[model samples]
Target: MAIHASPRVTEILAQKYVEPLRESGEFAHEIVESLRAYVDNQMNIPAAARSIPVHVNTLRYRLRRFEELTGCYLEDTSTVIEVSWVLEVFGRDL
Candidate 1:
């Protein structure tokens, strides 16, 4: 089952998350990268930091900003699961 980046998927994601990232500024990629790694690591902050090749403090800052921008909470299990899926679907499509 191979998936490709489709315009429809991208467009939907754009409305849900991408648009916010775009407004987050030039370093938005860092936030996305960190978030992907965070979810990949089962939402473990320290592991996410190591995976992102950044210090824990940096990742914390990005996560804070992510919550601020999205009104999503990393500490919440449901939010974490939702975000993980969003990242998975969004990445698979891309």
Candidate 2:
């Protein structure tokens, strides 16, 4: 709970992590699921797409959309760490 004491004054880290995402009208539960699948598959598009039961292109689109929404490129190590942390922390809630 101490993590909530950030200067940002957000709520739980997981909730805070997703705040901007939820504020984006384009955000969807599917995006979260896709993220989970994608990360779990080690960012492998083919495996993630198959796991999500979506086309690979669809998965790529979602990834691009996620980047657009968060301004965090999946190819970036820092962003990957941040997003993977978000997913690891809040994936169950999603």
Candidate 3:
């Protein structure tokens, strides 16, 4: 919170991740929500899907598309941490 609120870091992080997701247009919210759910569920696809009440395949597709758009692989620990941090920074903004 300090880092995000103290400077332009919030904007920077948002530009790096959120903006690209937003480019997905109508699907932006869906993808972001899916990502939040996935991360919150500890990357457990089934759990994430159940939380979202979406099909497993649908969550999988959103995650895949998230990777494609952000060029960030969810399989990487650092990537997940970084993405999670970015998500935290934006929160409702996303």
Model 3 misplaced regions, further than 4 Å: 5-9
lDDT of 1 by residue, 26-48 (tens): 76778878889888898888998
Top candidate by TM-score: 3
Highest-scoring model, lDDT? 3
lDDT of each: 0.74, 0.72, 0.85
TM-scores of the models, in the order given: 0.74, 0.74, 0.86
User: Lowest summed-lDDT stretch of 10 residues in model 1?
Assistant: 1-10
What residue runs in model 1 are displaced by over 4 Å at the alpha carbon? 1-14, 92-94
Tens-digit lDDT track of model 3 for 1-94: 6764645765666677787888888898899889899999999999999998899999999999999998889999977887787778777557
Any residue pairs clashing in model 2, and if so which? none
- The residue-level lDDT of candidate 3 at 19 comes to 79
19: Cα error in model 2, Å:
1.9
Which tens-of-lDDT digit does each residue in 1-94 have in candidate 2?
4333452432443454476578655455778888888888998999999997999999998788777766668898766666776776566554
